[model samples]
Target: MAEPLSSLSLWPIGNCQVSALIDDAAGLVWGCVPRVDGDPTFCALLGGERQDEGVWRLRLAGQVSATSQYRRNTPMLVTRLEAEDGSAVDVIDFCPRYQHSGRMYRPVAFIRIIRPVAGNPRLEMLLTPMHHYGTEAARTTRGTNHKRFLIGDHQLRLTTDAPIGYIDEGRSFRVEQDLHFFLGPDEPFTGNVAHSIRAMEEATELYWQSWVRGLATPMDWQEAVIRAAITLKLCQHEETGAIVAALTTSIPEAPHSERNWDYRYCWIRDAYYTVQALNRLGALDVLEKYLAYLRNIVDRAAGGHIQPLYSVMGFAELEESVAANLAGYRGMGPVRIGNAAWTQIQHDAYGQIVLPTVQGFFDQRLFRMADERDFESLESVGEVAWKMHDQPDAGLWEFRTRQLVHTYSAVMSWAACDRLGNVAERIGRPERASFWKDRAAKIRARIEAEAWSDEKQHFGAAFGHHHLDASLLQMVELRFIRADDPRFQSTFAAIEMALRRGEHMLRYDSEDDFGQPETAFNICTFWLIEALHMCGRSDEARGLFETMLAHRTASGLLSEDLDFESGELWGNFPQTYSLVGIINCAGLLSRSWDTVR
Candidate 1:
């Protein structure tokens, strides 16, 4: 296996409906057209012998190098390709997202505008879209000013101002008028290509800037928070409001380790954290959207039993399978689609589903505040949590080879009932509130009695399992146990002793279905920082937070795993969990805005 030259110089541009990842040189290295979970239209980043097939590249005939950046406060990406002879071109890429008609019109389309910025710059356009994950080429047909690609059952029309034949042949052409390309629906582009694209670019820019203005970000690291918030927002499947775990999947957690798993689906745990992170910045649109998603999910559950995850479109069944179409990321092989975790009974989800949606009952600013009907639906989820709080199932680490009454799951279940109690009161349901509060008390009492090891003087991962899991740090965050509690203090010490490796922390060092994890789980480290801050180690937490910031890619993004020793990023790209960590830690450690004024 070989490492990709595509540096994590990876940048993202999207309209809520679709997302595209571009390389530093303005090549569309990876993207799921029409939808985030849809088939990959350009998948070189996943790796194979035929990576060039699904890629879209804009080559400056004699280019030396290029530099890229997002237009401030917008998803628009610009790449300046400078040729050795001093000629250059600026390639601007964005997916139009703005208000049109009475509603938001975030089309599942990508728009690229190219213009020569320096002397006589020449350009070569190469767009080779593939189907079935690069197993077959897309059938093509040419039109007057457009080209249609028959990708699987769908027809994608690419309307461009550049000569169709010239683009198809990858021929060098002198730069003249600004060239605009829109690849989306099969419907004919109804307006002038250049004019419509220009208008879209302007509107999209204004849309993102205005969206950012609404954020109540911490005074420090506002840019990083905004970017992560925007990326998190892009993961949302707006039609149903399901938030995906990440944009790309099957990127191995560590090199050639069989850890690559599809992440384009929605996990209750992941969506909860994603919602919580964004909500902290006052991004209520996501919460309001996801709150409806949760309500629909609970409405469909049988006896209040919900799976760990679901398809972004809210489908119940997501049978896992491997795609033989292309070799895995860096040819690691066994590219997987559809996560099997969807079938697992992760008891933690009952709590995860409850935590975010309950906010609507209390928050005054929501357009459609939750009502008693919503509370009825949520009470069913709490019922499940009460029934399974101590029952065996997959824990948050999602171990496949074992089942235990995971302490984290019990803790989350406790949180679910606890918050429901608070929400029931807010909604004026005194009897329901007392019922929930009593159940929450009983769950918490059992967790303390069974999960705590008096001899070890620390909390274990499960009822009797002495193994340390980093999730113990979440106790403080959940308010289940105060950071200063002696039990929590000892559990925190135990986790650091058992899992911490220098500045990094592992979720667990125990071997699982795929052997022991070699890299540090990115978010686990953030949990440690937050734990440290709450425990009055604020200076140390601040120092570690600074160190983690230095580890972010040029894009200020991170994947799921980082090398505990070398700090190399691995796992799914633009991992939602990892980005949420950045947002949370920055908020936790930054100096207060009050002193700024």
Candidate 2:
């Protein structure tokens, strides 16, 4: 039987195409195939209490304990499982992704290399894949050296050097030699299994290390920044250049809160933050590809409407549904599939699109520079931003119950017009620059007049309300207000008073659609840290950042939320937003290289 779906202590391995979540015991608990938003082939992560199937586990007979870590700068995970007799086995897991032919060759494949490192080890291989969101097991057939799993027009073939019969029947066998397993598309692997996999591993390691070598990492917390950067890269679907919010869906924000929602789709707001953080690290490849995705989205919008989220393939309309078959994370139930928020009105998206697009106009290292035609396309999005600057929508938190002119949304709209003005000036269009700058000024004036609350001496969550939220801290980051401005300082102080919970910070203290959030939003906490630094509280910001770093999982990554009191990670696995926070905070707080040099 597979182990029960336990904690969020999971490690992610991917190739920018597909990803998997491996538990501490080296079990492949959750993985979606073909793409990040596809079916959950390994769905044991949500298989309720005591998952019996839908997992791929290399079990060591008489296993005592297991420990796992990443391979330095890459997503290649190395897990060491020790038996009671001191015999141990090292399980190396990775998805094959490296440069090949004349282009990048990232296939939908997973590779596992098992080697005995200590005394004689006994191994049991259990490969069970589920179909249709864990409703049924994938029917299997076997050959002499490979096993094929059939799932509704799609097939996955497992080519291995281990005894096929042993794996098919789930029997324990003594491991006297190394074994390699390649589970990928339903096609023949063209060479010697052992030699080809080893070469792929070496090439993949080289690819990631070389990529890391090019990063402009911070002087301190370099490892944490690198890990977070790699995790963000994994969340991106390179085929379309769209980045998902998180790898898995239905991992509740707070346990039993029924607040679970699918995060596998691309959010314009999230991707903007992602590109911004990655751009800080000098990772332009991701920025270039993501800009391509944004252009497509802008072109499709045709200067009018824009959604908050879209499928990784640029498709709209994600009808949210529940997976009745799977029990949920830790048996919490109501495993959701698609996101309903894609249909909601999130006016902040216009600014998100413009914020990242503006970078393309000025950056010289990019292969393709933004031209007049690109600016014209961006103007359409800017028009929407102007139209919706004061309009009510779902806001950034996606409140399902009410609609209001959120301060964050209006500020983002202002940022859109503001950046367009900058882009226009960069492209030598003084007339257009003046037009956008005027609109931005008008929006800024309105925000300053209405969003401030004299009663509470802080900016409200919405235009006329006095409720405080952590997103108000974005005023400095978005350039809406000077950090030293008295109003912003007062706003920051008021937000800290209401939302600060010990070392963590909440998105808000009041009730929302979910009856008050039960945990601290990870990215919100990072926003507070950034706000503290900007407010001239450098020491306090550094201390809080250290506390947040200490709360990351053993894999040096965070999810969407963290329990304030217990410090346990909750929400979806490998959240791009939380990972972006790590990179951004590290870059902001790290000492200058001159000091170290």
> On a 0 to 1 TM-score scale, where does candidate 1 land against the true structure?
0.98
Report the Cα lDDT for residue 291, model 1. 89
Which digits, one per residue and each the tens of the lDDT, describe model 1 over residues 198-309? 9999999999999899988888888888888888988888888999998888988888899889999899999999999999988889988998898889989999998999
- RMSD (Å) per prediction: 1.6, 1.0
**Runs with alpha carbons beyond 4 Å of true place in candidate 2:** none
Error of 2 at 209 (Å): 0.6
Query: Looking at model 1, which ten-residue stretch has the lowest summed lDDT?
Result: 1-10
The lDDT of model 1 is 0.87
Tens digits of per-residue lDDT for model 2, 327-369: 8998897999888898899999999999999989999999999
Residue 32 shift from truth in candidate 1, angstroms: 1.4
- The number of clashing residue pairs in model 1 is 0
